[model samples]
Target chain A: MSLDKHAMAELIANDIPRGAYVNLGIGQPTLVADHLPADSGVVLHTENGMLNMGPAATGDQIDPDLMNAGKIPVTELPGSSYFHHADSFAMMRGGHLDVCVLGAFQVSAAGDLANWHTGEPEAIPAVGGAMDLAIGAKSVFVMMTLFAKDGSAKLVEKCSYPLTGVGCVDRVYTDHATFLITPDGVVVRETFGISFDELAARVPVKLLAPAR
Target chain B: MSATICDSAAEAVAGIEDGSTILVGGFGMAGMPVELVDALIEQGAKDLTVVSNNAGNGDTGLAALLAKGRVRKMVCSFPRQSDSWVFDGLYRAGKIELDLVPQGNLAERMRAAGAGIGAFFCPTGAGTSLAEGKEVREIDGRTYVLEYPIRGDVALIGAHVSDRMGNLVYRKTARNFGPVMATAAKLVIAQVSEVVDTGRLDPEAIVTPSIYVDRVVAV
Candidate 1:
């Protein structure tokens, strides 16, 4: 069976180093905060001028003022600090973040990311912080499904959708497999519920064998 | 003390005319200046341009302004949240225009305007369609797109408290864009929950100093 969203989050969480300052993009990538180990020492940053953000708040704990870029209520940990919007973006665009996890509409074999818009006329071009996080984070980890709902591969030879950043994604964690993107080529690190050969057959691009 | 207090929200935004560019402070509903926005609507200013993080959360505030067809254009980062139906409907019908900026770039452009910088290069949106029509330069072997500063004709902001002199304090994350918007606008009108004496506010607690504020209306 293909891994669900939570399983995909857990898989992505495995790669986050301790004490890393991370930004969780809207949607599935935000789930990574829930699965992070308590001792991981990860400091969550929100683009709207908050640092040390905790998991999503629920029920009575929800504070309308305490929300992420997605406009969802969230809790704050001790030592949380708020600043002006400019200073917050300075942290993201200035290469201060250790890693940022983002959801992708498409990722290319060469590590290009396209998550902002589908280029549809009806689609609202809400770029948000994706372009900043995609290029600003020291390492960008894209969490998404291997295939779209239409059974088409999201990992492609070239991204058909508008790009958020070029040659920025370092790794991709999908329901079917985890791929490491290096300058040389795409490398399959591991697979779930399928063999390397099966995963290779499903994808459009050539996948290189992992270095032993 | 400076007498920056306005008797009403209408008085605070009285001079805003058609085609004026307004910098609205908030992220979602957190720090929105509802009274000031309502006054702008009641003022019946048409063909206005708004700069904010999001278009609007629901049927009130900025959305109401858009619904009334007061806004001709929106410059924002995220304009497609679930409650942003007004913008979506107008944009689809070609009634309103949209200039989508990356969140960080949006914030930096405002800051650059406030800080008196003409133009600066940013690494965000370097290789994307957003970079189109902008100057591109390679810095330290990396590409950066040049973005100009963004200033506004007026700014409507919300704060927790404001002293008579207009020194403002914000509640938690509600301060999102208020501080920066205050500096970038020609006339800064702040909606505060309460008004206090100048000496009553702690020097360190003030987020936006009185120098940048032009008017204050307690809602």
Candidate 2:
């Protein structure tokens, strides 16, 4: 079975344990929350002040008052608490979180993440809380496509985009493969398990995915 | 009574007192009221409760106050997102208070206060712990939680331009909370990089009219 972006995202969400304090990075990374098993006690933390978040609302139940950093409306799960902005971050920086799920524009072989800033001066330079979440969470899981817009491998030997946080990524779940970064190198434990030379043969340009 | 003209940033923010609640404008650092925050820090004010979207990157915007040991409490949607130096520093020192509200909720609360709305029912905190002690009401068979209005004693705003009459215009993210907080405070003080003449400011560009403004200071 060939897995698509949504399928890979769902597979990643299934791995999150119960009672996880997680942060969903903006963009496609947000779709993971929808795939989370209903039985798991995962608490979604938005850097914009929310914990124990649920899926997006359907109809007029949508409260314009409750939204994430993207300003999109969301629903709250059981046992949710609203708090002071600093306290929400205290949870992140204090390392009280279990996992952080983020979207990446690129992931280097060393597991560097570059998702926030595009390095273009004309682009908005705002990094927001991606840096804090990447480094602060116990585990950082990046969800991204395996390739770039121009068909170049986004899983690169080194990220061309400006880094949001250095060497903080734990595992990368891409549309094409799920790769784990370890002390040795990139290990393709599941989905795509080609040897280093074989993996390099699968694409053109420099190989950034963890070298096994 | 002699009218004292305060020209410097420190002199302007000296009017604020300890334990006072202040509103700061800007989504990020794009249009933060830097001059007023600087003045507040220079004045060495203490035990302040600040309301803003996010603390500016450490050493700027609201983070400056968080760094100076001046702020006692912060009411915001995303304080830690900036990873500001002061957030960790002050929080660990136990010198600051924090209250995290949903982003849209905080904005609405400020707007509610400004619009003279006492309290409203929202479905934001239904099944979550966010609804712990609040009154839960059912309207049309659906449950809604109550949210209180947010107001401040003073609103410290940054503006692109302001007329002598106090009409204000904000640029980019600086427009985030400026207008809402303007009408939600007992006193409104604006720091404008440029000051202009009345009636010259485009009507559509006026985020806050002079009626809600109490004082204007040129940065």
Candidate 3:
């Protein structure tokens, strides 16, 4: 059975090392914040100038002015601090973040990432902090479906969409399976429901078995 | 001393001529200077350039200005929110120009302008299409793209409270770009909910000092 979004989030959460300084990209990646273990010691950073941000706020706890880069209301942890936007970007671009989880439209076998724009003329260009996070984070994890709704594979030989970062993706967590992009190739770390042979048949690229 | 409180929004935005660039502070509508934007609309200055995080929302504020065709160009990060129809329509028709900077780059460029830095190298967009035509350098085995500073002729900002001395405090997330914009502009006008006496505010709570603010209008 393919994992649902919540299940996929839980899977991603399990891999997060303790005491990580993480930045969650806008959509699906943001869900990872809620599933993190309470004692994970993860410090969440929002590009819009907040650090140590807690989970999403609900009801009266929602403060209109306290929001994530995605414009969703969020709570601040006890040691949370706010800084100028430039300083915040400095933290991101200066290799200070331990890991950043991003939502991807496409990831290449070589670990290239393309998440920002589809390059459609009519589409509004909204590149929030994807580029910085993609290149700056020590480790980059992509959270997305393995295939598009149209049944097209998102893991391709090369990215058709404009790239967010070149060869920056380290791991990909999909509903069907988890894959790691290594210097050798895209390796199947784990699969949810499908047999290894079936998954290999479905995937467009060659998949290596997990290293013993 | 005393703050330079303007009697009206029009007076606060006075001298904003055509073709001028204005830095507008806010992230959506939260800390937006609505009254100041309204005053700019009423002033009807044409061929203007606006710098902000988003293009605009819905049919009001910055959107209203765009709808009126007062804006010649917009330099922003995210220009395509669901509510940004005004910008979308105009951009599609080739009537308005867009400079889509990365969110962090936009902030840092403004900060660089304020801090008197000419240009700086950043690793954010170094290898992407956004780095096209820009200078790229290798520093200590990492690639960085050169980005220049962005400054404005005037800035419209919002604040929760201001003392007559022009010391300002923002309300929560609404303070997004106000402090940085204030420093990057030649003239800074703030729209505030209330203005207290000069010494009424605790100095520690002030985010933007009077030095950067030129005028204040209580909305």
Number of backbone-clashing residue pairs for each candidate, in the order shown: 0, 14, 1
Q: Give a tens-digit lDDT track for model 3, residues A1-212.
A: 98999999999888999999999988888889889999999999988778899888999999877898888888888999876577777887778999999999999999999999999876878887788789888999999999998988899889999999998999999998999999999999999888889888888888999988
Residue runs of model 2 more than 4 Å from their true location after superposition: A1-212, B1-6
Residues A1-119 of candidate 2: C-alpha lDDT, one tens digit per residue: 43676887798789998878888877777888888888877888876556787777779757644566555677777776544344455577568888888888888777787876577
Error of 2 at A100 (Å): 19
Ranking by TM-score: 1, 3, 2
Q: Write the per-residue lDDT of candidate 1 for residues A1-212, one digit (tens) a residue.
A: 77999999998887899999999998889899888998999999998889999877899989977888888888888989898788888998789999999999999999999999999977888998889989989999999999999999999999999999999999999999999999889999988898889888989999988888
Lowest lDDT 10-residue stretch of candidate 2 chain A: A203-212
lDDT of 3 at A196: 84
Is candidate 2 or 3 superior in lDDT?
Answer: 3
- Order the candidates by DockQ, highest first: 1, 3, 2
Off by over 4 Å in 3: B1-3
Local distance difference test scores for all models: 0.91, 0.72, 0.89
Return the TM-scores of chain A for each candidate in numbered order. Answer: 0.96, 0.88, 0.96
Q: What's model 1's TM-score? A: 0.97
